[model samples]
Target: MSKETRLREEIVTVGRSLHMRGLSPGSSGNISARLDDGWLLTPTNACLGELDPGDIAKLDWEGNHLAGKPASKEAFLHHAVYAGREDSGAIVHLHCTHSAAVSCLDCLDPHSALPPLTPYFVMRVGRLPLVPYHRPGDPRLGEAISGLVGKHSAVLLANHGPLVSGKTLEAAGYAIEELEETAKLFLLLRQQPVRLLDEEQIEELRQTFGAQW
Candidate 1:
């Protein structure tokens, strides 16, 4: 298969996986992958469970929609991150239950929302920051994400959900899942005494795993 064809099929496959896993439901998320010319994004208002590979939207680096369905309005947010982080080849934004629940809680440190609970969470998703709430598709949301994308590969949108970028689509998908599960753990263990990874431990993970600490 051609590169474009492979990417299209991969997008559909990942979308279906995410939907079936309950990470994204009811058209409440968007997925995109960087392309040679620009990128491919899930269509606006399209359910992840029902995406057609051929109907995924395509755009130039300039953000002009070139083919297939109309692109998600949050495509700009993906673009902003790609522009800032050359290593990011794919992005996944989802309003998963646990992560969104964490986003709604008060007094979260804007710098690092989820503490490093498990080694896998630290390895897969390093230092997730929190973005102030903005209405869905608000242009300012892109700006907010852009400001922090260079420093963080993942961020939780306050009162919204998590946005994660990775070197590949699978990496992005897995990272978001880790973030969601970690968020769930955080909530479950909030009242109990927990052992979080210390600074030295986090640094060790970063050095060993090459996480974007």
Candidate 2:
């Protein structure tokens, strides 16, 4: 298949997976992938489970609707990340339940990224900052994400959702999934007083996986 065709298929596949896994309900998430001339994005209010590959919206770097149907209303968040970080080729945003629940807690560290629950989380997600809450599709949400784009690969918006960027759409989707899993783990372990990985092990993982931030 052509590159664009493959990207469309990938987006559809990932969107369905997110819906099936309960990471995003109804039309609560948006995804986008970079293209040579512009970008392809999911449509506003489209059910991710029923997303049509051919119907994905296209836009230029400036967020102009170049082709296909109208772009996602959350398109600004995707554009902000892409414009702020050259390394980000794809972006995924999801209202996964566990992550959203954790975002509501008062004790979670807002700046520590994701906690070192597993080596995979350390390697794949690193540190995910907590961006303060903003109304859905609010311009301030994009502004908050823009500040952390160059430094972090993922962020959890307070009372909002997780936003992840990656070199590819699959990678971005995987990171967002990982974030949800990590949040689930955190909740499950919170009452048990579990032993976290030691500082030495965490440092070693950091050396091997690079910085969490």
Candidate 3:
């Protein structure tokens, strides 16, 4: 199979995983992988649980739809991150339950939304900044994500969900899963006093694992 064909299959597989696992429901998420010329993105309003590899949209680097279904409206959002972080090979944006709940909370720190609760969380999804609220599909939202590019591989959109980039499709999918799990844990332990990883320990992980903090 060609590289593009493999990428389309990867998207379908990952999207189904997210849907079955309750990370993405209805048509509330978008997934994309970088292409040599542009990108292969999940079609707009397509259900993650029902995506067909043949229906994936192909677009040029300049954003023109070349074939298949129309691209997701949030294509610009993916483009913004790719433009900002050349290292990113794929992007996953989802309205997973816990992450969206966390986004709706009023008092989260914009710099680091979630604390260092687990080593895997810290390693997979480093310091997650909470982006300011913008209406879905707004152009400004993409600009906001672009602003955090290299420094943060992931961001939780205020009143929305998590958007994560990775060096590969699987990496991006795994990071977002970690983010959602951590968000669920955060909510579960909200009322209890929990021991978060200290700065020293966090630094150690960052240095050893090269986590994007």
- Cα RMSD of all models vs. native, in order, equals 0.9, 1.5, 0.8
TM-score of 3: 0.98
Off by over 4 Å in 3: none
lDDT of 2 at 19: 95
lDDT of 2 by residue, 66-158 (tens): 777788888989998889878888899988899888888878788864578887777778888999889887988989888887888888889
Q: Which residue pairs come into collision in candidate 2?
A: 113-128, 127-212
Rank candidates by TM-score, best first: 3, 1, 2
> CA lDDT, every prediction?
0.91, 0.86, 0.93
lDDT of 3 by residue, 141-162 (tens): 9888887977889999999999
Score candidate 2 by lDDT.
0.86
Model 1 lDDT tens row, 123-202: 99888899999998899999998889998999999999999999999999999999999999999998899998888988
TM-score of each: 0.97, 0.94, 0.98
Give the distance in Å from residue 51's predicted Cα in candidate 3 to where it truly belongs.
Answer: 0.8
Between candidates 2 and 3, name the one with more favorable TM-score.
3
- Candidate with best lDDT: 3
Against the correct fold, how does model 2 do in TM-score?
0.94
Question: What value does the lDDT take at residue 152 in candidate 2?
Answer: 87
